[model samples]
Target: MSITLSIIYLISTITFVIGLKLLGHPETAKKGNSIAAFGMGLAIIGTIFLNNLEVPIFIYILIIVAILIGSVIGWLIAIKVEMTKMPELVSLFNGFGGASAALIGIVEYGNNQADITQVTTIIAAIIIGSITFSGSMIAWAKLNGSLKKDIRLPKYNLINNLLLIALIVFGFFIVNGSINGEIIIYILLLFSLIYGILFVIPIGGADMPVVISLLNSLTGIAAAITGILYDNMVMMVGGILVGSAGLILTFAMCKAMNRSLSNVIFGAFGGDSVAAKKGSTIGGHIKKTNPSDVAVLMNYADKVVIVPGYGLAVAQAQHVIHELEELLTKKGVEVSYAIHPVAGRMPGHMNVLLAESNVSYDKLIEMDDINPQFKNTDVVLVVGANDVVNPAAHNDPSSPIYGMPILEVEDARSIIINKRSMNPGYAGIQNELFFNQKTSMLFGDAKETLTKLVQELKNM
Candidate 1:
């Protein structure tokens, strides 16, 4: 029975590896998710029935019922959630993962405290999992607009550093048997949660992708710690995979934005800096154009690039924009989407949004690949994107996003930006691109404006 269970665990671990590899591309991501889920299901079955732990029938029934309820709720949420809310949904799910790991540590601590190794693992799990849970919840709130403003306490970085040191010292004392009280663990958990909230609440929404990824990595590390306590091979492997992948992605996102991990955590960027920018104004003449004029420009263009952003998702205009793409394609004009690494609220957000509307995968060119093409392009239609394409990234050293890499849309022959208004982007600074001689703004909801543009294109 032990051999059979080991074989099952091995197979499950293999599936996890395979699934994760398959997840690298958008085309196979769904398949990879299903494969990983199947592996997890296999692992659970092996643990429940194959393991010789004679559990009570009622406990088994309770587990099954809990699984059913959770699965139903998850399914409902996934189906009903709009594309615009996907980032918060992901943040919420990451929090649940952390909470689950922390719960396991709490429930198993007493049972495993006799062993020094188990005690260390449990303590580690509790700290990391607690922090991940609370931090991810705060991230979810910020992403979903439930927390509209960043709340920065006085000397927040100093406070956070002190709290972190305290957590480490407490954990070290507990591991060394200096703090033997059962209540001590609970104290650590409480402080860890507080630290998590403080860690995230000061960060502005612009930096949420990195935060989400970091929290996800923490959850994975916590899961691995719990797996060590339980001697679960499948769990350990899965956790490691998740932890490493999320960590790598976090660094990639930081690099894409031309920021460092330490800066992201301690800089508390896009909060106070952006708030100050809100009171300031950019001096320039705003050139405005209507759908007909923009449509005519696009119709006569040799090549056009479309840039999608958070506003495009909010307006639910992916389909309309896809229609516009198709219309231009039929008119002998080449159309492609220029996707910035951190374009939307989360990683790969723009790609997913366009994919939902059945946009060709090949047409969604990434930032580096498309930037040089902008010079040769006739028209660049920015659909509700602001920060990623803002010229401030290049010329304005005083701007918050000054050092970040941008879309370089200014290089195009003509730039037409669609937006509801001249409001600033997530960075809370005006886009200098809007005032450039070759750029014109089309003001309205993206969906309404795109629909009008498509109609105008058809007339042309």
Candidate 2:
């Protein structure tokens, strides 16, 4: 039985590796997800049947019923959630994973008279899992705009540090077996939950992606610790993969924003301090152009690069934008998408949006891949993107986004932007691109503007 379970674990691990590799690209991501889910299912079934733990029939039935109920809820959410709410959904899922790990720790600790090592692992799992759960929930709320402002107290850093120190001290006592009381355990759990809330509440909505990624990593680590308690190789491997992927993604996001992970966590980049400092506005004349004139420009251009951001998602303009791309393609004008790593609300958000519209994968270009093409391109069409294309990131030393990497749309011969207003982006900073000499703004709903542009091109 042990050998059979081991073989199953090995096969599941192999599938996990292959699925993760496929997940790196958009074209194969869906297949990757399905393959990984299958692997996880195999692992769960093997564990239930082969672990040889004495479980009552009633308990087994209850477990199966709980799983069925959870599966139904998850499937409903997956089918009903809109693309725009993907970030929130992702955060909520992370929270659930974390909560599950925490519950496992609580249950295991209660049932077993664990050794010091086991106690230490269980405590670590509880703390980290609780933090991930509460932190992810806060992140979800912030992303969904239910928590409209960053919640911070006076001397927030000092208070947070103190709470963390207290948590560590309590953990130390628990690990040493000096404190094994249920009350103490509950107290520690309460403190960990509080720490999680405090940890995420100060982070603003703009930084939710980074926070979400970080919390995901924490949840994975917690799950890995739980796996250790159970001696489950499959669980450990799955947890490690999730933890590593989340960490890598978090690092990539921080690098794209030109911010350190510490800065993202401790600096509170999106909080009120940063907001108060954003008094400086870009100074220049605003140039407005109609959709027909913009259409004419694109029609005559040798190459056109389209940049999509959160605004594009907000207006659900991806389909219309693809139509415009098709129209441009028919005119012998080369069209491509310039995607910034952190362009939309979450990672790969623009890519997902475009993919939904059946936009060609070949035309979706990464920042590094598409930057060189911008210089020779005749026209750059920015559809509701701001910070990703802002010149302030490169030119203005004082700008909050000064060190961040951005799409060089200004290098193109001419620029056309589709936006509803002359408002600042998620970062709450004015974009100098909107005021540049070669840039022309087409103000309206992105879908409406793109629809007009497509119609105008067809008329021509």
Candidate 3:
């Protein structure tokens, strides 16, 4: 590597590492984000200056238009989207990444499939990217509530494996053969895309975090291949960092749920004999409460913690929740936001949503940080969250969600949940916490419920 390229790589790597570290802390998250963005900017500048790749004016024009469109849409989302809905938006962004990678592969094949050395990378990129794109889209749809939140597919282990094998066999011919048919690559790409969507379809909603993490890893692999194609050191490094981080997260998610990564990958969960023996045989009995009663409970509490979820996203109520937090803080009640790693549909879903509402990053506490505090918390206000706060994670071995690490919300002195109804979370399992004597279900739109609570506090 040239001196300049090496230096740039080192700088970019440092920024990403530090940025990720800061992001983990919550308190330093803003600075961490700035650092990461700056690092990306610097790398882009370096790429532009390398003076090697000749770009047509039209391509530059395309970049300009893309930037304009992206900036406008991003700004609108930043301005208008509720914190709860951020997870789905992230899924969409992930789709963009995966689709871009796949398209690059398609373009590359059209331009240079005659060469043998390039074929492998090209095929790999296409496979990884298409799958990521389609899978992420499905995940986004689920998180956004744009699609039905159900495990829509039955177990099909044999068929799924055969499809993969077929894809592999087709991939071998496409990569090894020269200059005959680009149609094969297209067919393979389409199959991979469909497979990606199907891959996540059988997964119960409760496993979204794991799905998102795995998809992230796929996108990283695609980026890395693209980097090799272009001989871009910074891109390669970034891809490696993202890929490794995603894998680690995937493992962590599996461990948190007391699940094996293999089980998650293979879609054999529902039929498991162990599932009957160990799953969370939770409740079909769900109860509902209102906001004013919840407010009274909150007013009496010495301390309160708010748990947010995908339901909150669908309602777009982060701002109102922020208002509730501010009210709690003024009344001398301690207020903190408990964030679950996979609470919504993606990683950092809650964080970005809260940030969009201008919620102080310091107020957000991670699952690890907040679990201990729950015991001392007078009330746990669960806003549209189900699976994460369900006691079934600990008590039910027969449940599909059995053994997953969940917030010990049941440990709190009292708990209040706001949701549409007794709807099962993405995992299709009942939340047992609603039956707890200390737990009260608050049924309404999350936004409306929180608004009523805010009003009740004012009346107090």
Candidate 4:
């Protein structure tokens, strides 16, 4: 029985590795997800049947029922959620993962008194898991606009540091068995949750991708700790994969924004005052164009690049963009999407949107891969994208986005930006690209503008 369980575990681990590898690309991501889920199911089934736990059959039945209920809820949410709400959904799912780990730790601790090592592991899981849960919930609120303003207390840094120290001291007490274990554990849990809330509330909206990634890593670490407590090989491997991938993604997002993780967490870059100031900072007149005029430009162009952002998703313009892409393709003009790493609210957000429209995966280009192509492109159509194409990141030393990597859309022969207004982007910075000689603003909802352009193209 033990050997059979080990073999099953090994097969599950292998599938997890392959699935994760496939997830690196858009074309294979769905398959990878399905494969990984199958592996997890196998692991769960093996744990329930093969593990010689002397529990009642009724407990097994209850466990199965609980899993079915959770699975149904998860499936319904996935089916109902729109692409625009993907970031919020991701945040909520991460929170659930963290909460599950925390609960596992609490239940396990209550079941039997553990040795020092086990106690320490359980404490670690509880702390990290609690923080991930509360922090991710805050992140979700911010992403969904449920929380409108950044929340920061006076002397925030000092307070945060004090909380950290207190959590560590309580953890020590629990480990040493010097105090009432139950009471100390509860105190530790409370402080951890508070720390999580405080940790995320001050972060600005622009930094949400980084926060989400960081919280995901925390949840993975918590799961890994739980796996250790249970001696579950499959859980440990899956947790490691999730933790490492999330950490790598977090670093990549921070680098794209030219921000240190520390700064993202502590700087609170987009406050209400800063956002207001951003809107008030335009000094030059913007060149505006109609959709028909923009269509004429693209119709004559040899190549065009489309840049999509959060606003594009909000307007649900991806399908219209695809229509435009197809029209351009039929006209013998090359059309490609230039996707900045952090273009939307979360990592790979633009890609997911485009994918939903059945856009060719090959036409989607990464920032590094597509930057040089802009120089040869005849027109760059920025669809509700701002910060990613702003030259301020490159030219303005005093700018908040300075030193960040951006698409050099200004290098194109002509630029047309589709937007509802001259509003600043999430970064709370004025886009100098709007004032560029080569740039023209096409003011309207992205989908409406694109639809008009498609109509004009068809007429031509």
Candidate 5:
């Protein structure tokens, strides 16, 4: 890179780092996103100008049209998508990132003169980007519940590991100039995709936040490898930032759940779908309470803490939930939100929903910040939340979720859960929190139930 280009890369790289740093807290996340995006735009412009392209005018026209189309489609999706479906949207976006990186490597390799080092970079980019892309798509499928979360077959673990090794070996052959290896390349891609699907298959819904974080890291690795191959300083730095941040967050989540990456990757835990079926009846075991009754309890309580989960997002009840919180606060009751590390479909699903709804950022407390406080809370409001509150994590030795950490909401003075029915949660486990002595179930739509509670609280 020239001196001038080096300066540009440095400025863009700085912006990305600062943006990521600002994003560590919710209050600055929006600004962080905008800043990061600006940096990326600058990097792209810098590259286009510096690449010294001698392409035809029609090629330029084609590129412009593609960008416009992509921008328009992305905007439409952003505008219309419900918050409940954000996880799938995120997965889709992540998959695109990985796919784009891998394709860039392929095209670069195809258009270039070959040597050992260049070929190594090409191979690295292809292998890493393919894994990232496929892994991300599989995560999308799992979050969308399109694929069942289970082992899917006996000894699948061994088979998947062996296949991953085979893919690695095949990649080496492609890099070493194997004769007409294009067919082998395509086949390897197929195997990579299948490996990703099988890898995340045995991981239940409870592990999705970790899965998302891990995939984000993989995407970053792919981008970094591509950057190195292309000798792009900005790309390399930006990719490193993303990779490091993602990995740190992933590690934190693993620790929060008292789990290791290997345990989660190998699906040693989080399989609870059959727990409800084999266990005692949820209704017969737990107290069933109405919304109005729960409303009265909330109105009477001195403090209430709302715990949200994937179901709350599915119901798109964050705004309605805010109204309930507002109503409680008006009644001279202290109200706060307890956000778990794996609260929703993604890592920060609850935070994003609440932030979008203009909920007070200060009201959203992290798991550690709110766990001790939950014990003192007069009424713990579980708004369509499940798995996170399960007591099995605390005491069940043989439980699939054993050794995992959970909210201590079961220790609250009283608990009110709003849900449609006693369906097992995505982890496929019966939440013992629902059956606690102080817990009461309010069966209905989260949005409507919260709305009803707000009205009832107003009357009170």
Candidate 6:
């Protein structure tokens, strides 16, 4: 690479690091993304203009056209996508990254330009990239409700293990030139695609967050392998950063859920249709309350903490919830949010949703920080959250979510939960918190109920 290109790569790498650091907080996330995007743009331009490659003008035109098309489509998706669908969109985008990496490997392999090291990297890219792409698509489907049931074959674990072993052995053979036929490479691709499907299909809705994180990390690893194949500094640095960050996040989420990576993969813990079947009756009558009652309760409370879940996003009630928070704050009630790490469909889902509605970042407290505060809280309002706040995680050993850390809202003086119906949450199990003595279920759409409660507060 030319000195100018090298300098551009260095700048890009620095921006990526800085941007990732900024992403640690919601307040600077948007700015961090913009900075990283700018770095990527610079790297692309530098590669096209500064790299002394004898590429044809037509090829350059084609590349430019592809970039334009992809950018336009991505922008449209960003603008049109609802917050509820953000997780699916993220899954799709991760898949695209994997697909791109896989294509790079395939093209390089066919070019006959690879040494043994390059060959090894190429095969690794193909396997990991194919898995990432296929697995992400499955995750998207599940998130969008297209695939509602977890489909597991008899002896699926053995099957999956065999497929994985085969893939590793095949990839090794290809790298060593023991496999010389084009058909062999194509077979490897087919097996990889199948393995990806099998890998994700058995995973239930409850573990979707961890699966997404794991697939994202795989995509990054594939990108890094591709970068190694091409000796591209920017791509290598960026890929390593993404891969490591994603891996760390995946492990963290698993820990939060009190499940190991092996368990998440093979356990199939929370199957959608079967979860309700697996649930034992936490027999207690639920007390239903109206919006007026909830508003009156909050009005008297000194400190209030709101817990948001996927239902909040589903109803597009983020802004309304923020309005309620502000009203309570104006009334001299200390308001904050209790954010469970695995609360929503993805990591940081609650924080992002609340932030979009202009909620103060300071009011958003993580599970560990907020759990202890619940005992001192005057009232706890759970908006569309279920599994994260479910007492089964603490008291019911037979429950699928047993031993998982929860918000401990039951410790509060009063509990008001808003939900559209008595339907179970994503885990497909009834929440025992709803039946707690101090808990009152406020039944209605989150947006409508929260809006009414806000109006009631104003009337008071």
Best model number under TM-score: 1
Worst 10 residues of 4 by lDDT: 271-280
Q: How do the residues 38-149 of candidate 1 rate in per-residue lDDT, one tens digit apiece?
A: 9888988888788887789999999889989999999999999998889899899999999898888778776766778888898899889999999999999998888978
Regions of candidate 5 where Cα sits further than 4 Å from its true position: 1-3, 26-28, 148-151, 178-180, 272-284
1 against 5, candidate with superior lDDT: 1
Candidate 3 weakest ten by summed lDDT: 270-279
Q: State the TM-score for model 2.
A: 0.93
User: Considering every candidate listed, which one attains the maximal lDDT?
Assistant: 1
Per-model TM-score, in order, reads: 0.95, 0.93, 0.82, 0.93, 0.91, 0.93
Residue 8 in candidate 2 has what lDDT? 89
In order of lDDT, best first, we have 1, 6, 4, 2, 3, 5
Q: Each model's RMSD to truth, in Å?
A: 1.9, 2.2, 4.0, 2.3, 2.6, 2.4
Query: How high is the CA lDDT of each candidate model?
Result: 0.89, 0.87, 0.80, 0.88, 0.79, 0.89
Stretches > 4 Å off in candidate 1:
26-30, 273-281
- Cα deviation at 168, candidate 6, in Å, is 1.6
Q: What is candidate 4's local distance difference test score?
A: 0.88
lDDT for each residue of candidate 3 in 392-440, tens digit (9 for 90 to 100): 6777666667777788998899889888887666665667688888888
Scored against the true structure, residue 116 in model 6 reaches a CA lDDT of 91
Q: How does model 5 score by TM-score? A: 0.91
Q: Give candidate 5's error at residue 244 in angstroms.
A: 2.1
